[model samples]
Target: MKKVLFSAALFFTACAVSAQESVVKEAKSAKSDPVKAAQIIEPALTDPSTANDPETWKLAGDFQKSIYDDENMKLYLPGGQADTAKLYNSLAKMFEYYTKCDEVEQAKVQSGELKKPKLRKKLAKTLATVRPQLTNAGSDAYNAGNYANALKFFGLYVDAPQNPLFADEDAVKNDTLTPLIANYAALAANSLKDNAAVIKYATIGKEHKEEGYRSLMCLAEAYGKGETPDSAKWLTTIQEGVEKFPSQEYFIGNLMDYYIQKGKIDEGLAQMDAVLAKNSTPYFMYVKGVLQYEKKDYEGAIATFNQIIAEGKDFVAEAYSKIGDCSFFPAQEIVEENSKLSMDDPKYATNEAKIKELYEKALPFYEKAKEAKPDNRQLWGQYLLNIYWKLDKEKYNALEKELGY
Candidate 1:
């Protein structure tokens, strides 16, 4: 018992320390020893096995963060390390790369190497210049509080590095601007999940998920932002963005989630109709299940999510986790709100009975999620803890002992 208590205490202490230490790690790495920095970076850049190690990734992240934060280091990748013409000229080359990919993809379709998607050759060609166009347009939208427009424009800026879209215009006024602009755009977009601007940027990132790690941040933000938007415009904007950027799973998931949160079942279902037009992805299906869950169509949601868990073998764990999360709170909330009366009082019993039904329905989903994500012990433990919360201490103690929590 003492050992277990000590272990739990130590774990909590470690988590707290990690959180506080993260901020300082960035500051310290700025002036790290050259040999040690190089040693860390070598493994990070080349060793796949060591790729996810925090120490290595953080060292590189800190180095880049410091350079970006440094006013002097905010210069060029396209051309000008310092000069104006060189900087924008380098931007032109990035546009040239966008043009290259666009041309290659378009030509592949025309030459029979790829299927002609709905937004094919013409769309691809237009996107070639999209990056450069957004560089100027997104800043305009951002300053005006039209994050929707800014997000859209920023999406264009992703393919071509020279055209940084998400930063303050003043930042772009310098010769060394791309990294600063890129980082800032990423930051700004991340800060506004429901802002249409975030949806737009994430959509672009979704397509180029392979090359742009920056997109991943925007994708997560877009999903988070759209969950409870302030306006209907945000909903429509995100919906449209998802339709347009099917490959951008981040935006699509966020938009669909918004549909669920707003209690717009029909609208969410309609959006799924849109999702079906393109190659269907987990992001799309996940939204559909969540929408049903929000509507209290538990069976429908569970069945749909079950199909996803089965079909998406690689994503089954995440799929179950989502189902668990989607059902847990909603059922709990309903049960809690209804648990006001005694079981014998007809009025009180009505709500209490409903509460039991909700919990009964919800438990299996959470348990299934736990089973699917066995490695995610913390999440599984939390689910068990919650279940125990609804039960007697004797039962809770028994389960806790069984799980060693």
Candidate 2:
């Protein structure tokens, strides 16, 4: 009876060994059929009895990664191409498995249970190659207007710490592509109107030397678009951007607008003054003139604008127009207040004389502005006609005929 029991146990043990052998053989033979191989090894990867086996994890990784092979990817992935969103999940899964394989193998190597010189090198190559795949996926998603997925893919590339190629220096030093990736992510987030995401990604790019200026602008714009934006934060970002990117008119212009919006024209003037004190650039001087105009300092604005014209800068036309505007404002204020007054009043002649004097001051600047920028004839044409009507009806009628007014 004992022998009979032993025979039965032996038969069962043999059957179990044959079944394990069959599975291993099938796993190896199904290399071209990664789907089949994956099915064979998945159980071993999860089974507690074999879960700790590094070889099982490595097999799982290999099978998953094989799904991205040039031929296999086209056949198995969506879009029937290597560079489609359909391959994103597959590529992501490959990265995950390979990371696990590397981790388990490295642990075994540390414990003196494995020797993986060739495998470690291979894993490094694979991780580096995965980076471009992620980038391609991101580009594909971006071109498709899948901004959320574009951001996700780019973020994955930027934050992928499991990559052996980046494992050493990624934590301590910034990657050369890090800023560009963050910038792209910010662009994607911005397209989606994800203000928070724009702030987050652009902040990363803002620290980079090459992309910092663009990132700062993006961040500032994002802050301005926020539901409950912090004006101080927006102001700070624009100021910083202007300081760092002095050549970028967008930042300086944005900074000026912020001050104007806050009713701090004096502060804007002081800021422009400080910038001019360092380097009296034509643009800066022009901006100072604008701030003066906003402050209703017509004389100061005219003086500053004259200085801009003297600089022989490209903005001379704009300066001339702004100077004309400065002269017009006071006369406009007087007309608005006293237009209702009867000509019989004693004050009428005095007011008319004052208005004429102001129009005279504006006339030459408007004429020069038109001469300098004939392409913008329409810009100051109405003002010119109005001034002419007040002081010279003949010129007004001529200009009205020319402008079809």
Candidate 3:
């Protein structure tokens, strides 16, 4: 029985030695036939003695990564697709194998089995070359309409340690590509409707110095769409975007709509007032006018609109339009009051005169707006028809004919 057991142990040892030698030979020749090479070496990754062997891990990693590198070459061969999914899978495996190699190498160094600084530096150099490849894969996936896969690739590129292409893990600042990657990842998550991932990446991306406002917008959108929507967080993000990118009406406009929908016009006005106090830019001035108009502070709106005109801003037409809108409200009020009274009532004539005066006051601003924005003929025609009805019936009839009314 003892002799049989010894023979079995010898047989097993010989088989292990043969397997190791095959793996080494495969690794050496993998460049020419990487698929067959990988098939031979992958089992060693889980084998007890080889699993912790740095050389085994390194060989597997280098061989698989070479396979991944050659994938694009296959597309030039006859009857071959790029097979991006397969390429991405190979890259994923490469990263895993490289990471395992790193772990084993570090363990070997700690155990005094290897002297390491040189080996670690070489591994870092290898990782640096691989980093941008992952980013390229992400962009390719995104262009191919594979957003989830794009997210996976970008996430790996940005999160990998010692990537050299991105900023440190503590923050992704200073690196332009870092924000770009985060933006792409966030957009991918948005396309997938993965609200949580959108919030995650977008929130981080919002710290980007040059393009943070875009990320803030994404975060706001994500918050509204996420499960159990957080309106407060959404509002805060929108406000931040408005403050950071005051010239960008997209954020301000979204905030305005949010306030209007929630019946918080006064709150919106207060927020705009704060923004106006800080910068008083032409855009913010225009926003202040809009907010005041929504709050029915017509006189304040007209004054703010005038300030935009004084600044010689491009929003002059819009300002004139708002000023005309201010006069419209008072004119409407006079007409409404007059409608409640009989024509013979003593105050009826007085109200009619007041209404005509207000309409006349509004008409010039509307005409100026029309001159500034001639393409807005429909808006001008509507306002002119109202003014002509209050003052000149002949002109009203002629204008109505020209307007196809």
Q: What is the lDDT of candidate 1?
A: 0.54
Which stretches of model 2 miss by more than 4 angstroms? 1-30, 33-64, 67-93, 96-125, 132-149, 161-173, 278-280, 392-405
- Tens digit of per-residue lDDT, candidate 1, span 251-354: 66766666666767788787677676767766567767767777777778777778888786555665676566665677567666656646676766666556
Which prediction has the highest lDDT against the true structure?
Answer: 3
Q: Rank the candidates by lDDT, best first.
A: 3, 2, 1
RMSD of 1: 23.8
Residue 204 alpha-carbon offset, candidate 2, angstroms:
0.7
Per-residue error (Å), model 1, residue 320:
3.9
lDDT of 1 at 85: 32
Off by over 4 Å in 1: 1-240, 312-315, 318-338, 343-362, 375-383, 386-395, 398-405
Q: What is the TM-score of each candidate against the true structure?
A: 0.42, 0.72, 0.69
* Candidate 2 residue-wise lDDT, 271-378, digit = tens: 787777766678888888888889888889889988889888778998999998987878988787578888888787888888889899989999999999877975
Clashing pairs in 2: none
- The TM-score that candidate 3 achieves is 0.69
What's model 1's TM-score? 0.42
Model 3 weakest lDDT span, ten residues long: 164-173
> Ten consecutive residues with minimal summed lDDT in candidate 1?
164-173
Clashes of each: 11, 0, 0
